[model samples]
Target: MIRVYRIPFSTNVERVALAAAHKGVEIEWVDVDPADRSPVREVSGQDLVPVLVADEEVVFDSPRVLAWLDERHPDPPLWPRDVARRAEARVFVEWFNRVWKGRPNEMEAELRKDEPDEARLQALGRQMVAWLDLFEELLDGRDYLLGDFGVADVVAFPFLKYGRLGLPEGDDELFHRILVHWQPIGEGHERLAAWVERVDALPRA
Candidate 1:
């Protein structure tokens, strides 16, 4: 059995779990806290969660983990088969990891601030909205990022889900609009939603 070192609330870990589930791969979950870096470093010689350990192979980083899983279990493909579509999926995954790092901090400020500083909150909201608009433009008239559910969708969904839950409290309309854009590609889509449910049902490690 494959062993997955993970943090339950991490979007990165969720990406790997979702992909594994999508590929019908069962993984032994190993929970590790961010503060407890020793166990992770001991396993993979690095301090990152979502490390996948198989016989003689250790994969760190969520994207690499997803790719590793896809390569090992090719059935129910996580990536688009078309070359161009695959490239697009990779592009979105990169953007999510690199460009969206500030989202969580911004969201935290927006949600937890006692006085709700309008300037900071609006700036964060605008930044997120810009990304949302970009996603809308990319997803215009399409059901998923690459016109089919794939790795990009799985990688991107967790951030959106986290943002909805953590940020912009009392903004139902905003969240609803975001969900409307996300739902068809996320919860409303059978394959993707099933993957989500499977991940959700997993025992916390």
Candidate 2:
């Protein structure tokens, strides 16, 4: 059996869990306290949850874990079958993790200020809309990223959950507040709105 150490409400941790579930891979989840990551450190030499321990091998990082799972359990693969599409999916995931994922932090900082910068906030809003527009273009005719439910969707879904479509159940209020500045899903992003609805119904581990 596979064992995973994770903390609740962590999008990164949820990424691994969702990918595992989509691949029909069963996992033994060990929830860890955010204040105390010693349990996670003991196995991975780092205080990071979403660490996967399997076959006496341990792996950290959500993207790496997803790759490891795909390599170990190829059935219902988490990546697209086509080599080119698979490469594109990896690029999308990398860009999302490195770039767009950090935008929320910047937005939240401005939002939490006593006197928020309206002009800067608007700029951030425009940037977010631009990013969403890219996703809208990507989903031109496809249901999920790359035309199938794969790792790209698994990674992007958790962050996109806090969109301005009003809070879904269990969404972080602060995150929703920060992310809501972008264009609403219902307004111009019809495909993304539908994609969110479609992916929200998928299974998670």
Candidate 3:
């Protein structure tokens, strides 16, 4: 069986877990202490959570693990079958990771200042809403981001779910404020909220 070293609640780790679950791929989940990463280093020479040790092949990084799962399992594909759609999925993941995902944290930091920049906060909030609007538009007349639940859903869910469902109890207060600022996944954006539920309802293998 494959073993995954991870900090269980982490979004990245959750991505791998969701992908594995979607594929019904059995995994030995080795929960790791975030404070001490010696085990991860020993296995994959990195401090990142979600290092997958499989068949003597060590794969770290959430995206790589996702790819490995798809390659090894193949059944119920995690990516779109059409070539163009596959490219679109990858592009969405890239933009989410590199561009959209961290805006909340940035907003939180700005909020912490003694004199928060109202103009800047408003700007960031608008930018955040624009992305949410894009997500809402993308979901128009479709079940998932790309017609079916696949890579884009797997990558986007862990973060977007919070906008609608709100964070779990004991989640960071600052992050809670951040989500409140955007409120991207609720009544106004019914499609995105529904999509979150769809992904949330998937079997947790």
Candidate 4:
């Protein structure tokens, strides 16, 4: 059986888990404490949730794990089959990852705080929307990020979950407070909004 070492509420872990589900791959999830990641470290040589253990081998990194799963289960491929489109998808994934480098830290601080900084949230939201704007423009009349429901969508979907419309369907005050900075792009970003609904409705792992 495939094993995934992950803690709850991790974007990195969510990326891998969602991809596995989308590809119809079953995973034995091992939840570890975020403060103490010894279990994953023993296998991955580093403390990272989303470590994939399969075929007597251990893999780290969400992108690497996702690609490996795609190869291991090709029926519902996570990447495009057309060589050029596949390359294009890889480029976009890399770009998104690169631009999103420091966003998690900022987002975590903002969302987890008892009293989120309105100014900070506003600035963070603006920056995020700018990035989303690029995607909005790119997604003009398309169903998914790369014209299909694939890895690119899976990788970026977790971050968008904190938005008002996408915040986990729960009753946590922090989740509600985080919504302060999150404004729905509904008609302004029509295509992306539709895509959000589609991705949110996908079966999760």
**Residue 26, candidate 3: alpha-carbon lDDT:** 91
Candidate 2 residue 170 Cα shift, in angstroms, is 5.8
Model 1: residues with Cα > 4 Å off, grouped in runs: 102-125, 166-205
Higher-lDDT candidate of 1 and 4:
4
- RMSD each, Å: 6.7, 2.4, 2.3, 3.6
- Candidate 2 versus the native: TM-score? 0.87
TM-score of each: 0.70, 0.87, 0.88, 0.81
Residue lDDT tens for model 3, 5-87: 88745778889888899899998989887788999999888799888998889998888889999999988999887999899
What tens-digit string does per-residue lDDT give for candidate 1 at 1-205?
8999886466678787777777778989987866788889998998988889999999998889889988989988988888887787778778787776465455565556677676776665567655655655555566665676678777876666543343334434443343333334333234444443433454322
Residues 42-150, model 2: lDDT tens digits? 9999997789999889999989999999999998988888989888988998899888876777878888999989898788778887888888888998898678788
- lDDT score, candidate 1: 0.67
| Model 2 weakest lDDT span, ten residues long | 164-173
lDDT by residue for model 4 (25-140), tens: 88999989878988888888998778999878888888999888888899788899999999999998897787653554576677678997878867776776666677788788
**lDDT at residue 44 of model 2 (Cα atoms):** 95
Q: Model 4 residue 134 lDDT?
A: 76
